[model samples]
Every structure is written in structure tokens, then in C-alpha cells.
Target: MSRTPDFLAQGHDERDPSPWLALYLDQSTPLPDEVKAAWLTDSSSGSRQYLLPFLRPVARLTIILIQVVKVFVPRNWSHSKLLHRLLAWGLKRFVSPEANWLILRHFHLGSQVLGFIGRNSPAPVGTSPLEPADIDALKDETFLKHDLNLFNFVIRLNQALRDKGLVLGKAPQVDFSMIRDPGLRLSDMPHGKLNFLDLQSAIELFTPLYQLMLTDNDFWRAANSLQLDETIGIYAATLLGAPEHLILVNNKHPLVPLSTLRAGHRLVIHGLSTEMLHSLLRRMQAAHGATPTPEQPLA
Candidate 1:
């Protein structure tokens, strides 16, 4: 294949061809490798999608997933006992089996070129006198979603960062693959109500973790391309029942450090202050040094 030439322009003789070369590369609109890794990881996590070319193509799958999580989340779960104020804190609901399925289909997998804004976005209101009715109403309405919602929720913030000029770095220092199996297709899997319920409950717990990563713009913007790695390492085993494996980055590398990392969505561990990291590493090393590895039985 022919590549763009290194020749001089008609008007410009030897005036540093480097400037034009950089302009050409900077103008390239191809997706960054980090973004590509994120997408690939999300797909491995079991999101089902088939891209379509409808004129008004929307992220129906993600919307459906949000709706489904809304279903499982009991309303009033987030209301405080005193009920000092009412917040929109946009929370949607998933009402039935179908809604839940649709959500799973779109959950972690989909094109990155889309956004799923809920019907409402809650803002804090001034505190006021508490009321019994407010308490009852809150118990009856809001769900207990918390900061963990940041995972998949982060997609929104990444868009904001690009607008601010820091896009996924041209090359990510670290690499990762979102690893998973699709299980059997819906048509092939045996039908059992119990299994479905188990799946729903299990995912309900798992989705929140990914959603947390989605919200952590600070983490992503500062941490280089390891957001996906940290997300999986931190939450995979605990919330998803995946295997136990540790995920960590060492600050000792010459070219890599918290400051050199760019935030992706919101995860910020990569930008951890060096002093804090030293303290943490000391603790880890101390623990490891104290524990003796088990020896194989004499053969």
C-alpha cells in the first residue's frame, strides 16, 4: 500500500517538513488504541449487540439495560431516614423480564459513539425540615445506587474530557484484553426460571461495579490506559465471582508514573500521589515478607 509522501509542498522548500507531518498524523481520526481496548473488554463481558445503520440509530440496548437495572433497584432505597431534601438523582427502572434481558444485551457491550442519558438528572436541594411523609415517600420511590454506578456510567465523562482536549493517549503504556466467554446463545441455553433469576441477581451486583468505572473521570483522565485493567482487577473477583488475581502498576518504571497517565473516564488510582504509593507498597511488601510460602510435600 502506498503511504503519504515525505515531499515538500510547492510553496515551501526546506522549511521543516516535520510540521506538516505532525499535522497529518494529528488529523487522523482513527480510534485510539485505548478506546479500542475498552470496547473489546466490554464485549468480552457479555454484552450482546449487532450494529445497525438505521437513520436515527440510537443506543437502544444501553437504554434497555438502564431500564432493567432500574427495575431491580427498589425505589426508596436511596432515601435518607430524615428526608431533608428531594433530589432528582436520575434513576430509571427496569420493569419486567424482557426489560432485564434487553439491558443485558446492551450492558457492557456497544459502540462507543453513543450516549444514554436517563430521563432525569438529580441535583441537590437546600435542606429543610424533616417530615414523616417525606420519609415514607422516599422509602416508596428511590433506589440505593451509589458511587459504584460510575463504571459503565463513565462513558459520559470521557466525551467531556475529549472536549477538553485530552483524548485517549496516542499509545497506551499498558495493555489489556477484556476476557470472557459468551456461554451458550439464548436459543441454545436450556430454559429454567431459577437459572434466569440467578443470572439477574448476579448481574445486578456485577453491573454496579462496571458502572462505577464508567463514572470515574478523574481515574481515567490521569491514569493512562489501565482503567480497564484496574476495573477488572479491583471488582471482577469480588462482585462477579470471577477468579482471584491481583492487578497493580508499579511506579518504578522510567517512562510511567501517575502524572504521565491521562484520565480516561473517572478512575484515579493511576494518578495516586507518590508518597501514598510508597506507603502502600511498603505495607504490601511487609505483608508478603512476613508470610512464608508453602513448600511442596517431599516426593
Candidate 2:
């Protein structure tokens, strides 16, 4: 491919070139600062769309039906805590072990990403970075120790619900050793590698973490792209299960799903892409004093 000077020009609209293409191009030659600014401005203008086009009609009809059904149902049916608890109880009765395992894995991945940030992020003048020996040690020391640890905390939470007559199936035991540390937002890992997450799993795992961190507007303001990407891969695993597909990054490829590019879609990762992973690997390798090689680069 031949490179052109104006292709990397300032004030270029990223969306015009399409996000996927823009990302790949931005890799070898970073876009001008003005181009990024303009791109972000344009991308951020859309409304949040949580449902698919087909689902929107179904959802509306379901809501209307619910309203109609409510007229005949007892008023207490909607507001009753006991009724809600009963529903939860029934739901748990159907919680398969596979479902429990999937939930545990996602939470475990989330915790690992958070722990990586806590350990590697710079500390304040009076403080030091958290340095846990391993996942267990990390679990014991982190704030999420009480609520986020899948084996201990989440298990306990499920037990508590069970104690209250909720029927949630037991959270499956997850092996934390399988979880890989996503080094930095800019770190890169080869797709064939063990730690790499494909598009679907990437989106599923990060969506909740993104919401959790961005819940507070102040924290959202403080967060950077690296934090977002690294936490999500914008965050995935080896032992539990592999991603459904090998993620690709072409706009016109029939194998690639266009719905992934839409905001709030199940596969949306905003701008998080392979570029972030590559940058992260380089940064982390340098931090650990490991020399990068083509055969074994990145974390």
C-alpha cells in the first residue's frame, strides 16, 4: 500500500473514512490531533440505542400488552416484594450450571481488569501501588474483595439470596490462573494467542464494566481510552471458553457484522480495537523490563 501525505491530514473526519478503516490507518500513521478531535465530536452526537430495530417493535408491543394485563392483575402484584422474590425464586430454578459458569467467568474477568489497573496505575505521593502476589492475594486486598470476588464474595451473595428463599444456582468455581492481565490499553496481543477475546465476548464483558465505571460522571470525565479499552480488551479468557469467532476488522467483509458498529449494540466496543491491545503489550513489556520479540510480544 502507498502512503499519501494528505491522508494523515489534520481535521479529517474519521467517520467519513469509516471507523474500522480509520482505526487500521491510524495504526501505522497516527491521525492528526485535529482529525481525532473532529471524529470524536461527530461520533458522540448520536442517541443511545439499546435495542435492535426488530426488537423495538416487539418491545413496544410487549409493553402495551403488559399495561393492558395490568388492568386485570391486582395492584399489589406489581409492587409486592414477596411477588418479586417469588419470581426470582422461580427464575433461579431454571439457572443451569452453564449459565452460572458464564456469569462467574464474566465477573472474574471484570475483577482481573480492575485489579490490573489498581496494581499498575500510578499511586499518590503518600501511597504506593497495590502489589498482590497473585489473584488470591489480590482478592484479599482489593475493595472488591467483599463484593466482586467470584469464589468468595459472589458465592456468598448468592448464598445470601438463597437464604432468603431465592433459588439462584451456585456460582461455578472459576480458575483465576487462566485470567490474563491486559497490560495497557495500547498493548497488542496476536489474535491466535490464548488471551485474545473475539468481538462478541469483548463486547459482552466490557459493557457492564463500562457502565459501572462511567456511572459517576466525575469518574467518566477522568477515564481515558486506554482505561476503557484495557478494561474491556476495551476486556476475555483461555480456560473457561474461547470467543465464538475470530474477530475481524473490515467494513465491507461479509463475515464482519455491521451491527457491531452501532452504538449500544451487543458488539459495540466504541473505538476499542486491535491497536489498543498492541500498544498495551508494548507498554507493559517495557514496564516489566522484558524485551519484546516478534515470537512473544505483549502480555
The estimated TM-scores of all candidates read 0.18, 0.25
Q: Write the per-residue lDDT of candidate 2 for residues 1-299, one digit (tens) a residue.
A: 11122334443564576453354356453323333333332232221123234444443354345445556655434222332243233223332222222222233344443333222222201112223332233223232321223233223434555566643221133222212433321111121213222223333333333333222231122122212332233112211122321242212332233321132232233232332233333344455555533232112
Which candidate number has the best lDDT?
Answer: 2
Our tally of clashes for model 2 stands at 11
Off by over 4 Å in 1: 1-98, 105-148, 151-167, 172-176, 179-299
lDDT, residue 230, model 2: 26
Q: Could you tell me how far off, in angstroms, the CA of residue 2 lies in candidate 1 after the best superposition?
A: 49
lDDT tens digits, residue span 1-299, model 1: 11123322223445654543343335232223322222222232222222112211232234345445755665433323222122111111211222222222222211110111110112111111111122123232221221223333444444544566643322211111111111212232222332222222223332333333232332223233334434322322222222332323222332343432112112223222211222232233344453211231100
List the candidate 2 regions with Cα displacement exceeding 4 Å.
1-57, 60-91, 95-99, 124-299
Quantify all predictions' global Cα lDDT against the true fold. 0.27, 0.31
